[model samples]
Target chain A: MKFSTEDLIEGIRSGNKRLIAKAITLVESKKAEHRQQAEELLKEIMPFTGKSIRVGVTGVPGAGKSTFIENFGRLAIANGKKVAVLAIDPSSAINKGSILGDKTRMEELAREENAFIRPSPSSGFLGGVANTTFETMMICEAAGYDYILIETVGVGQSEVLVADITDIFLFLKIIGGGDELQGIKRGIMEMVDIIFINKVEESNLQKAKTTKLELKRALDFIPAKEKGWKVPVLLGSALYNEGLSDVYSTIDEFISLKKKTGSFEGVRVQQAEKRFEYWVQEYILSMMKKNNSVEEAYIQHKKNASAMVFNPSTEAKLFVEKFLSKGPD
Target chain B: MKFSTEDLIEGIRSGNKRLIAKAITLVESKKAEHRQQAEELLKEIMPFTGKSIRVGVTGVPGAGKSTFIENFGRLAIANGKKVAVLAIDPSSAINKGSILGDKTRMEELAREENAFIRPSPSSGFLGGVANTTFETMMICEAAGYDYILIETVGVGQSEVLVADITDIFLFLKIIGGGDELQGIKRGIMEMVDIIFINKVEESNLQKAKTTKLELKRALDFIPAKEKGWKVPVLLGSALYNEGLSDVYSTIDEFISLKKKTGSFEGVRVQQAEKRFEYWVQEYILSMMKKNNSVEEAYIQHKKNASAMVFNPSTEAKLFVEKFLSKGPD
Candidate 1:
């Protein structure tokens, strides 16, 4: 099952599922040889990427995120589009796996021939987890997936990270009874492009309507995340497959609007630049780890700082001056 | 007005207000010679710093932040403690100045001999602004200020930055007519060590009670920010000076709890470490800017990246390798 670099490129280009998954594994690997091959494969597949609509979905737990994605994926396939689903859980290591790791959680979407699902890469720092997810998205795109769905638990900073990598950010929430809207996370309200109120049915229809209006009022206090786009909140029952078409149409209208305004391309470009910056920061930190002089200086300064013998800022300045003059090995 | 370094140190140690202000101006300056002198002053003052209780206060506009600080400062001064108030507004440039710049904002407190007020520094990036504020706090501490109050607009990322440098983070909010708790910014709730429901008088007392109960329920969903502390929500009217004593006592209790648990010193050490890291990052970025090969390669890679000829991550790796091996000059 060990594919050569050329094999990965060819297999991925031909939409070979196994090879696509293998390529993702390669990219996620920390091994130096695997990383070299992964980089090579990523370069070869670059042109084939950026062909899909990347959507990020986030919500509190028990909000029916998996059901919504399953239904959404199926709907996309019904329209003759291939779909790929990926999860990003920074806490995935302790949680065993993300919601997507258990295929049965998304059984309907998992059985679809045009669908692909990958769990959160249960390891690494926040940036690394996000990088792997981004790489996985690219691999899915090269495999001809027309839609990419990225999921994140709305509890942490991952929501911001996911919003950075995707074109559309969809927030899903469910109101238990009353006054739960205040529980919506802080900065997330400003980042959401569209919102889905899941689990709306006969019993909670009135409650959902009230929640929607309340949410609109709350949204009024915040500025639009994007120009020429008013964030829309739609109610639905994902478990019953209710209101799936509305969700699809809303996404359609949003994508077409963003594309027409040229912000679609603009966002992708910004995302690329941000991605580049992150990689540069990672590279610099890694290099610092390997440089003995930098490490020694850092430890010495830290000790001095803790003992109150030197100001942290002054210590940092002195360390940097020494580091640059001697060069990092 | 031009005091030598030794004279400035003596003046500060003796608690001369003019010298303290001059020292702050020196640290805030970007001139090379001034920076060297500032560093020296900071190292010499190290033994005198870390004596004050640092408190950060943030609230939405018109939430009576200035009035609250005025009343709170008066309370501290009445208790035989000197207090210094500083503001941090990232949007200060366009907004003319932070709420504190006018002096009239806290006229009563400004007139008190025990109180010193400094407006937000009207320049630099976010980190630079925070660094200046931290240095100013140290200078105030060395001058025997018993309390340092840092104020942020509670709108931007400044709340997080302010939280990083202070020992206690207090969030002041007022509930309007109905359901205004939803207006609370997301992540701020998690960082708050104490919450003050400001403007709680006869008319809004009922409304404030509802908001308090609702906020407490919402807080239930979030884990404790610190191990031994339970975040408290208090009610008070800053303008009427009705609940100033309660706010002061709450802060006193929280600080004592933190000190008893040893987390007070632990937090300061962590803050020191974070400050050092930020300075290092700033130094590296500045070095990269001055390095010609790094800039040339950056532009070339940027061009290739925009043209879709090179993946940004790979480009970043290549650039770092070249920069480190050749040394940044």
Candidate 2:
């Protein structure tokens, strides 16, 4: 289970899947020594990280996410692109194997030599899961994956974070109960660069067409993510191997357009800035957690706040004052 | 202009409008001494706070939000309730005097003996505006206002923060461009306790009715804020002086139902807890801003990140390590 730093760096750069997985697991480790090693490994692999086409996939459960990714990954491989699929389920910790935890979830994709599939980290905290996912993504990129599909279920804040780290965001929708965009949050809609209406079988083709029109109309009101680029809502069935090529071509078109406009590179830098901001918050929170007096003050303040002894803002101000006066470790 | 703490407290408690305004201005001041005075004033007025029906109102531009608030406040006064209307336009700092800045926007309500209207504080940051709004709300409560309406233009993060500080969140939507929920964000829809489709004139009555039904169906998919509460979408014309009483009665019913279920008090405490969390972040951010080494490191890391020298997470980790080792002020 233990590997030298140079081994991880070499294995990652040489596209060794086993060592890549190990590096990801190592970064996910909470051990202080492992964290130091992980940081060093990441720095060594920095040159290889930004070459992949990063795509984010999100949809409600039963929306055929696994199937779509499998078909899409296969299509990319057919087009001579190495694919890596990573899932980020913030609920994975509590739900305990509800989502991509099982390799069988993406069985076909998992069996592909050119494809890499990893489950959610089960970190319990969104930030922890996100950090590991980012690390895992960089490791995959170093391992020569030309395409990365970062998948997250449609729930809570995970999708938003996934969108932040990806070059393009894809949303999958299933027509059910006649309520189009029911589970989709408006913010997610705004973030989406492409949408796929999955499972458009012969029986539901009409319904799919209707939903697509409605979705397009709804999208017209929402601003496009980039100038001169329209978010296309494509209909396809991953199960039937239908419209997969269209989906693949659309993604390629989006990337080409973004690159042509020069917004593509700008976005990546901004994403890095956002990631840095998240780390700043994470570090501050970690420091607060380590301080005993801060912990005591937080507890006392919460109790007094419940009893309305003082305003919560006042208690917070007092807590911060005490914390700053104590100095950092 | 300069009064003792006792004078301010007595003025707030005795419902002296001038003194209440002065106390709020003091809290809005960024001066260190003024902050200390504001803390003292807030703590002294703690007992008198949390007695009013705290309501938050939000709508897109031209959603007739001011007209609705004016009518709603008048209705509350007709029911023998003292009303306070405060606007929280986060954009006010940049778009000087765009919304609720001029007293004439709610001229009728402003002239009411029992109604007090305050324009949005043109503090640039959303947090600064929200903090000042919270303080002003508490001051209004101490001034014996039985009903407080916090108005924020539906933009950015202001609506979410406003929802956190208030007991009930009401969303005002205007039927426009044939898009029922064109500008309304989904997260806002979820947080909304009640929705009013404003501008239902005779010509647009049918359109409003259709929009209301469509909105009701949309709300069905989103879970209610409270366990037993169904978020109602009501149709009303704020300009025509119609359905204002219905809106008032619905709000009263909601409060009573929540009170009977005992969730009302619990929500207020949770809101206080949320406000405390915000203050914690604000203080940490302020501390980071005050630290010079942290600033220098951030700039350097940003440059390196843009040049693709290292992963952003790695840079952020280095920055955090440096910041903590520097020790706090």
On TM-score, the leading prediction is: 2
- Name the regions of candidate 2 deviating beyond 4 angstroms: A125-130, A175-191, A203-231, A260-263, A299-308, B125-131, B174-191, B203-235, B260-263, B296-309
TM-score of chain A, all candidates: 0.91, 0.92
Residue-level lDDT of model 2, residues A204-260, one tens digit each, is 899999999888866765555788888999998998889889989898899999999
Per-residue lDDT value at A143 in model 2: 93
Scored by Cα lDDT, where does model 2 land?
Answer: 0.81
Q: Pick the candidate with the highest DockQ.
A: 2
Which ten-residue region of model 1 chain A has the weakest summed lDDT? A122-131
Task: State the lDDT at A188 in candidate 2.
Answer: 73
Clash count of each predicted structure: 1, 0
What tens-digit string does per-residue lDDT give for candidate 2 at B1-329? 39888999999888888888899888777666787788889999999888999999988888888899998888899889999999776667676777788757889988898988888785643223444788889899999999999998767788877887888999888888756665566477778889888888889888888888878766665545777888888887888888888889899999999999988999888877777777776666556656777768778986776666887767877887876677544
Which candidate has the top score in lDDT? 1
i-RMSD of all predictions: 4.3, 3.7
